[model samples]
Target: MNCQPWLKTLVYKCINIEHSCLLCSELAEQHYPLCVACEHELPWLDEHCLRCALPLPMAGLICAQCSRRPPAFDQVIAPWHYGFPLDTLISRFKHNGQWPLGRLMAEMLGLQLHHRYLDDLARPDLLLPVPLARRRLRERGFNQAGMLGRWLSKALAIECDEQLLLRTRETPAQQSLNAQARQRNLRRAFALASAASLKGSHVAVVDDVLTTGATAQAVAQLLREAGARRVDVYCLARTAKPGQA
Candidate 1:
């Protein structure tokens, strides 16, 4: 089946019109959503905990926190730190309803996956977004994580099962809580939707940001419980310090 000519034209126009970085409002020089300046200025967290992707004082395989209590996901891949133009872009995407920004974030994330996590980027068996609660979904009109998951799946040629993970409860935002409190709040907040599709699969969980990583950890734990062989995290940004969580 072919899309109607008028509809196709409309879609093309929508994608082409003077696209600019959401933060700088400068013309984007590349196909990706962010402008060149914004892209170059992205705060990359190179020295981080390999397991959690949290910024660390020195290069190491694991951070003290992850050592004390390991995260559910085996590994994390984040393209940038949660700050400045990247944070502004994320805020616009989540709070201001800028849907296209999700795709852009996914593109940058895909690049990171290719460069940093080369072994895993070949393609996961499935890509799942950390599910949002019904109330939050209603308020936001979209799940930013789900949107990114779809885009990432397409880019990576992996299947995206938007319904594989379910948020069992709506917890308060982790931004206002300490690490311990964040973990407690997110406990029991997620579950797998089905065991059939999950059994023996390697899944990649997508999220727009990783703060305390409580939400991702919960989701990954549930996926593993449901029989997923492995679960890795792919987030657009990671929080820099402790208080940010």
Candidate 2:
């Protein structure tokens, strides 16, 4: 007879006593789920915009576009670029419900953030996940950003408050819109709960990816309006603007 479901699960667990790097399948001997080689070779971010973390030719400098009209968030800390295998992994995790991939991504992000925090970066007083509207939440069954935030909050010992930010109205997906359209779509879409106040606080808004920075900008504006002293966008990956190199 075939093995029972529980027996199969037990066998799977027995086989996975040693964790392997998700990318190269090498045995991961250390913490955070990836082997040293694979971790180093992953699509790490570098030479990005100081403000939005958009991939660029130079590091520690803001881009010309941002110089003209700066975004509301003060800083962005992202470890990876949205490309290749990393993109595939994130898509599987976010859309296909492959939770293990998400956990691995979250752990990697936490490791980067920990390093930055130790190196004198200003750590946010709170971690707030970019909220999903009710309709999208229903369709997806879970918010990827919220899950990422939970992992990061625990790793850094920071307070995470996902309930404070509310998505008041559902709008078209940001990916389908141009920069102007995206801004217009998100206008007045986010609000703070009555009991929540960002007065004199610094917050990091957590998300899975920062593409055009539209969503982050919108949320940061809301936080600033509510009296938050500063806002940072914390994401796992930061994509180059639609046509930029």
Candidate 3:
């Protein structure tokens, strides 16, 4: 049967408005859906660790914490600090079902990945999200990391493997714990689903934020144990402080 024209028109309008530029509430002028002003205001990270992507003070190549005890991931890239409007944006994206922000964040991250890793990001064999535990996933009705990973994979033209990793244990929220407590809470919280798909693959792990780097470290360690050749983290935001847990 032929569709009704009026209904089709209404659907089209909804789609157009939904995809409109969030910055200006109009059609986007660039590949990313943000207007220039909003794009400029984003807290882009600069002078961060080449390995950890932690914001670094002047005259230091690596943060003292990473120098003292390095994480398992080969590198991390977080384009923004998790503060101010970025924090609000993440809250909306995670708790209020603001999916388009995920796309915008992923686009920005893809641009940063291009500028930072250059050719290496272009050639990653797979993309994996830091998995959410099944209970949390059910409660939240979605996994924010998985949403970010899918968007990133599309932007970077990489294969996104949603099942590559699994959160095998549920832990208390990291916000409530100190660094040592957070580390202890997250121990063995993640596990590889199976080595068959990930064997000898270079995987880029995606997440919305890197706070203490504990969760990402655990996931990377599991990936390596499952025979992943290399694992790098791609996050939308990172906490500003070194000792936050």
Candidate 4:
């Protein structure tokens, strides 16, 4: 046996490692930079639409609206509701470039998916980060979705392809538009880089938040047109449908 490994373990045990909570700076119990109390206080989605991850009154069922008009994506797996410190964290991470918070979110999301995978669900063959427009990318200095995808890809050992998906054109910000207008804004906004060999590949589009889900739906339709067998959406947080402005 290697004595080197034993020496390293001895040194590790000799050092007292302390993790502080991101929110309260209390001694954290979880590995994701958050204390048990803070983690429990987050707006966790207990019941949601299986298809969209929209907050619902009960669990383990699809919502009526989805049954009436199904979306292009087959399923969504979001770990939290888009509210409170999570929304604030995302905002700063996306706009102000607070990478630490974004990374923490990514770590937590990876843990959630890893635990959920015990069910032996159909895993995606490829992970694609929802593309940001060129203008937004230049302004923001980074694509937040892409960062999350990189983290998840490494964590789950899934292949992630950032170059294959293309945002062909820029559109109005989805947050500024209502559901119908949001759908219209994204029409013809995406295209595949190459339809080389993904005829029956299952792909999951990674994103930070699922708002109206117009973006995911549009991307799913685009992926289908590119011959993907199935497309799912994986988001860190999900927002409730906003009333039309």
Best by TM-score: 4
Output the worst ten-in-a-row residue range by lDDT, candidate 1: 114-123
| TM-score of every model versus the real structure | 0.84, 0.90, 0.84, 0.91
Give the Å shift of residue 236 in candidate 2.
0.7
User: After aligning candidate 1 to the native by TM-score, how far in Å is the CA of 229 from where it should be?
Assistant: 1.9
Query: Per-residue lDDT for 1-245 in model 3, tens only?
Result: 66799899999776664445675687665666787777777777776777787777642488888888887788887888776678888888888888888777878888777675675554578888888877878888999988888877787788888886777788998888877888899898877665456678788888888988888888888878887888888888888775542
Worst 10 residues of 2 by lDDT: 12-21
Model 1 Cα lDDT, one tens digit per residue, 1-245: 77699898999778776677765778875676577777778787777898988887677668878899888788888877887777888999999988777777888778777675466443578888888889989998989988898888878778888876788888887778898899899888887655446778888888989888888888888888888788888899888775642
TM-score of decoy 3: 0.84
| Global lDDT of each candidate | 0.81, 0.89, 0.79, 0.88
Candidate 4 accuracy as lDDT: 0.88
**Whole-model lDDT for model 2 versus the true structure?**
0.89
* Number of the predicted model whose lDDT against the real structure is largest: 2
Question: Number of clashes in every candidate structure?
Answer: 0, 0, 0, 0
Question: Where is model 4 poorest over a 10-residue stretch in terms of lDDT?
Answer: 236-245
User: Candidate 4 lDDT, tens digit per residue, 3-111?
Assistant: 9999998896566356788789988855567888898888898789988889887898888778999999999999998889789989999999999888888888888
Tens digits of per-residue lDDT, candidate 2, 141-168, equal: 9999999999889989999998999999
The runs of at least 3 residues in candidate 1 whose Cα sits more than 4 Å from the true structure, single-residue gaps closed, are 1-27, 116-122, 243-245
